[model samples]
Target: MTHQTTPTMLDTDVLIVGAGPVGMALALDLRYRGIRFSILDASDGTVVHPKVGTVGPRSMELFRRWGVAGRIRDAGWPGDHPLDIAWVTAVGGHEIHRLPFGTTDTRPPLPYTPEPEQVCPQHWLSPLLAREVGVHPEGPLRRECRVDGFRQDPDGVTAWATDLRTRERMTVRARYLVACDGASSSLRKAAGIPAPSRHATRVFRNILFRAPQLRRQLGARGALVHFLTQPPALRFPLRSMDGRELYRLTVAASGHAGNRDLDEDALAMVRAAIAFDTPLQIVSENVWYLTHRVARRFRSGRVLLAGDAAHTLSPSGGFGMNTGICDAADLGWKLAADLAGWAGPGLLDSYDTERRPVAERSLEEANVNLMRTMARELPKEILLNSEDGARARAELAKELERGGVRGEFEAPDVHFGFRYASDLVVGDGDSDSDSDGDGDGDWRTDAVPGGRAPHAWLDEGTSTLDLFGQGFRLLSFTDEPAAPPTALAALTTAFADRRVPLGTTRCHDASVAALYGKPHVLVRPDGHVAWRGTQLPADPGRLADTVRGAR
Candidate 1:
């Protein structure tokens, strides 16, 4: 007689390792595309000491697509809080320079995007996304589930994980696996991907505390961030985390160049940064190493890396998490296409080709911000009340202005100006789509191939961006008494024959047509322009195949 044992098994179209914001963003996108996937995380989905403070505008737009942007906007941050960035000697001390960004309620409407950036810390954001991804027992997200290892074969990937609470063994099989396991990703190591450091690592400390009465005491003088210019000890940012009582103060862990003060007192630093005595409680202290690392490759066999796993940059400009979210958006639709059996041989490969460059560029930009902050000179005289102190403060302010410190806070191009260049994207004449920023100030209107499609208002409350989400979209611009070109019929038939999901929209607005700079535009599911021209190609099937990564 032989005894047989049963195996606990799970199967999905895609298996996601890690449930941080980046991983959850991917889940949101996959859910939007009606795909089956599972997210595994070791933690219980609680963010105690949040690292990310503000979501960038591009990430907010993607969150809008995922149907949670409104929820994030309503997640307890006050609407009337000042959105300014101030360089001060300390809180309630001498104001060196101030970049005034009006409050959310008073800021002028931006013409480029419908959704602006929002201040949603990870603690508030994680729970909202977890609920959206479904946290039930039968749901796609499995918290307290740690994946130990995985193996890939010709058919799919098989992962072994253990429920941390029960210590029970389980197996997960999927066609593809994505590792959003963060900067110290073990799966990335297991896959033999090398993420070499691009800059020397430095350790910094964050002190999270609740100063209940601090906001009331400051009154109209409050700002979103107070960049401390204190000499030798406190030269980092003391930020308002929740626009409420919670705040975080960052400092160099080593004090000075050779101080070696690893056991520095946390409360002492906090008090030194605050000029007035107030009721406060220390919540937690975190010491994190800042490293600049980008993986040599984002994919290895069937396993892919995203978020901090693919690239880890300084948080000086808040680009780390936002870049990872964009990575998820780019990969989400491609994975769906592959699962639906419509992906070309080169479609999945374009994820690496398109996103790796963006990561490198963002890493460089973030590092520049970091170096600027690190190189700032905080003379001891800047803290005095004498005329020399005032002179020092004025000189530093002038230097900051000359260095363009405001770009770190007010860079819309950093958020929305990256263009993808790959085999899947069809470029027009002399179109160098690899540029990272808006060179000619036309990023908001130019529908350049391999870039995000331009946004225009179709009506009072609707934007042209609202037209494309679930699949490919074809926009036809026709003036009055002029019908859509005859070539549209051929394009629609060609896409239909290949079973590709394509939506067609005909617009008669001359202004919108002029903004697009073309009579016909094809937008990908991720909202990037695939191709735009005055007339469709004679071989519509070839155009469809080219955009689908088949040609």
Candidate 2:
């Protein structure tokens, strides 16, 4: 007596769950690779309480590849605002230490990167990415749609969702399913991948407010972040969210609570941090848990995890979102390779092997930063203006100097220092060689296998990094060119036979050659070095096959 109907099927090469910055980043990468993918999110694409404050330099480089770096740089943050990090007894009170990072417009160019970090808070970043991903009816983005459940087989994944607005049920059939959902990913739990916490989970509160005249009042005393040293509750950061009037103050949640205790007054906390009266309007207050977690596995069968779904770390060093963004970049090309059929079985598997370690390393670094703040002993005497207070301030300053607080704000190494070691990367096998030195060497100068290719200025406006992203790029130094006519022919034919995209560029720059530490360097799509040598391999076909994941 019942009528049966076939479910509506929406097919795509990839289905992305969650529309956060990491998911949007994956969408951008897939779009650039000419891959068909759809994004799903339950809520409308609006970032109400922006959690991310800064996009790291490496992430900015990836954004540059996606054609949105320029827009992110110009996202409305004032160019003249101080980027300094100041430690103070209170906002308008005695300053303990100041680490001066010049404003965006006046900062000297970094020798290691073409793009530096940008402060585009999630509120401004979300709409920009959503527009770039296309929010039209016929587009790949599906907002206000919640996926109730999904099932995956060897062939593909079938996910069914109901449009929250229209109540229309639909099914998405995709070759791969990526969970970019937050720290608490339902998909990850469904897949039985446990992201066990590595450290004790702590709760914190973020109060976002608008202080229209505060910037004008403070003037030159203003800084990007004001680390308050007030005893008991106010030993946290009050950061300028948008360089102008917007700001966010972080405070510890009340005793023995984890994001559930709402007893702390937000206004009082804000007032306690700022030592002066100003026109203030509270925007929103949020309670979030800081957990250091890394999933047991980054991939399970056809289901892959990226971003916070795979790991979650403290926001101390601003590495949480940046780490996830890098995950998207690493997973994007591997997914593309698998979908395109050029990927060997291990190529996709290498994603788990490579990215999981980086997440773990970042977790440790972030925990160090978090622990440093938690371990600090802030005395009430630091707040006084008397001689005793000055001594206390000086002693605290000395402790701050010894504690290395600058690492929290200015660790380019944390942003760009990671090296990827996997089966896909071909090591040169010379442990004693300068290029193959142990991991303690400076990352900026090493072109070691499984490391990011060093950046060198190709032109006034272009970097060596600009040559990567789309496919494998082989850079041959003219001083000791890796490929002769025959070698070039063999290499071209080898990669062409497998239909792997490869681009070759011959460079005559001695400086670049020295920076790379090799005459020939093979860089991956994600801008990590796959292999480097003084000359081409004996079997170009084998080299191609190895890097392409055939072996």
Enumerate residue pairs that collide in model 2: none
In the range 1-551, model 2's lDDT, one tens digit per residue, is 99666666799999999999999999999999999999999888877788999999999999999999999999899999999999998897899999999899999999898999999999999999998899748678889988888998999999999889878888999999999988999999998999999999887888999999999999889999999998666888999999889999988876454334456667877888888999888999887888889999999898999999999999989998998999999999999998888888889888888889889988998999989998899988888879999999999999999999999998888787777777788888856322422266456776888888889998888899999999999999855444578888898889999988899999988889889888888999999999888788779999888887889
Q: Please list the residue runs of candidate 1 whose C-alpha ends up more than 4 Å from where it truly belongs after superposition.
A: 1-7, 255-260, 430-438, 480-485
Tell me the whole-model lDDT of each prediction, alpha carbons only. Answer: 0.88, 0.88
For candidate 2, which ten residues in a row score worst on lDDT? 432-441
lDDT of 1 at 143: 91
Model 1 Cα lDDT, one tens digit per residue, 68-107:
9999999988999999999998888889999999888899
Each model's TM-score? 0.96, 0.96
| Candidate 1 pairs with clashing backbones | none
Candidate 1: what lDDT? 0.88
